[model samples]
Target: MNLTTKVNVTEEAEKLEKVLFSQKFWIDLGTTSLRIVLILIFAVLAVKIGKVIIRRLFRLKLKGPIRKSERRENTLLKLLENTISYVVYFSAILAVLTEFDIDVKGLLAGAGVLGLAVGFGAQSLVKDVITGFFILFEDQFSVGDYVKIGIAEGYVEEIGLRTTKIKSFTGEIYILPNGSIIQVVNYSLENSLAIVDVSIPFDVEVNRTEKLIEYYLTIVSQDKADFINKPKLIGAHDFTETEMIVRIIAETKPMRHYDCARLIGIGLKDYLEKEGITIPYPNLVTKSLTDV
Candidate 1:
């Protein structure tokens, strides 16, 4: 090669080597990586600390005499925890972008415009948020409530700003958008009724059956703390050719009716058997095909 060409090539190689082997460049890269790692760690710690604080604050409120509804407080606690996580992670991402020498302000500005444009097409999302806010404000339902929304019946697992989560008894989870919940039937808001029906032979006197049921209900009320008051024996709710139906109704704590009803049925059955009253059971008689 010519001398001038060789000199130019050597100068380019030296410049490339200097750029690659520079200690300052490696130090700056390491520093930037460390800062990004620290930023992420700080974000994670902030979320955890924020959650802890929220839980402690709610616990303190529960200890006070003028405490608010526990369900509402639990819902709010979860919402705040989620919000803190989202905000911290978002900030951490932006901080990391900044460390990479990207202009965060310009990115955010562009994002804002894009978000606005996207908002026009996301009407259902906006509706969901607005409806969720009203659901909280109006106290329609809260976490742990047994509710029926539309065709879904389950316990509320979470109430978020955009959606609600319900866990059914069969272990199915239903995630519903807030805007679609047109009606809600909350079974947890009031006491439940435990109704038990006892059928007796027509030969038994109605007055005697009523007296026995009344005594049995009084005993049940005394034994069980779930009963709000003594159960009433409503005489002769129905009648058939061979049997008379007697209805007993008890007021119980919410969601306690099913178990309470079963308990009452068991106790009453035992009591009636001891008193010589027999419950009738269907008798099946089978005949051979030839006999038929």
Candidate 2:
């Protein structure tokens, strides 16, 4: 027999056996009725079992350690678990009602209409889903990626079916609906530029300065761990009556460009001083009337 029939039969047989036992048969019958009343209890137990399974699976996901935004994946999974439990519990109630010969056809139709009405009232909800789909497929940004959307710039905190969460550098959490995300600048996707502008004084011999810089740059570039590209002393960028400006450029690895730049700055000054090169300082000249 099925679970329902077996349960009923067991309770019935237990009651009959107890009733035939002694003078307290009526009390025993009442206790047996309470035992059969635990049908809902079993359904609740099943829900608990499902939750345990969900927890175990989620813990395994944590161990796998896939990078995602906002630590929100855990919350989303919990919400799904709750939804499943409620849905299954409602289905069980409907099954029990069917056993009592209740017609739920009208109720189902009413629920459908109500659902449609609610859906229409929440247009943003629909927009959220549509936009979220496009965002993921278009690869707008992934978890742990530094990005800027509109006025907000930070590491992507989370990407959900409805909204995106951003954690700002200033420690503010910004929640943006995917539908509202019009412009996204993802900084983590490509290489970064670390440009250093080195200024030389007018009195310093320009050729000596340039050659020394180029020589040092070649050496720096030859140092495998320190350099990225062979440093190029580009054409003179600016010429003023007092001093000239030269721009040095190098292509370096992402995020480490700053490291290369810092090294260049510190090393450049020391190298120039050791070569007896002078850094120009601002000098103002005044003419006296008598001298003129």
Best by TM-score: 1
Reference-based TM-score, model 1: 0.72
Cα deviation of 53, candidate 2, in Å: 22
Q: How accurate locally is residue 55 in candidate 1, as Cα lDDT from 0 to 100?
A: 93
C-alpha lDDT of all candidate models, in order: 0.82, 0.72
> Cα RMSD to native, each candidate?
8.8, 13.6
Tens-digit lDDT string for candidate 2 (1-292) = 8999999999999988977886787666675555545546776888888888888877777778584433355554566577678887887677666545578777688889998998899989989988986776556677777788998888988888799999997899989999898888776655555455677878888898999989988887675653446867774777778878777766665344567776666688788888998654312122111122
Write one digit per residue (lDDT tens) for candidate 1, span 201-286.
88877677678878888888896778888877777777788898777777778777777787888888888778877765312122
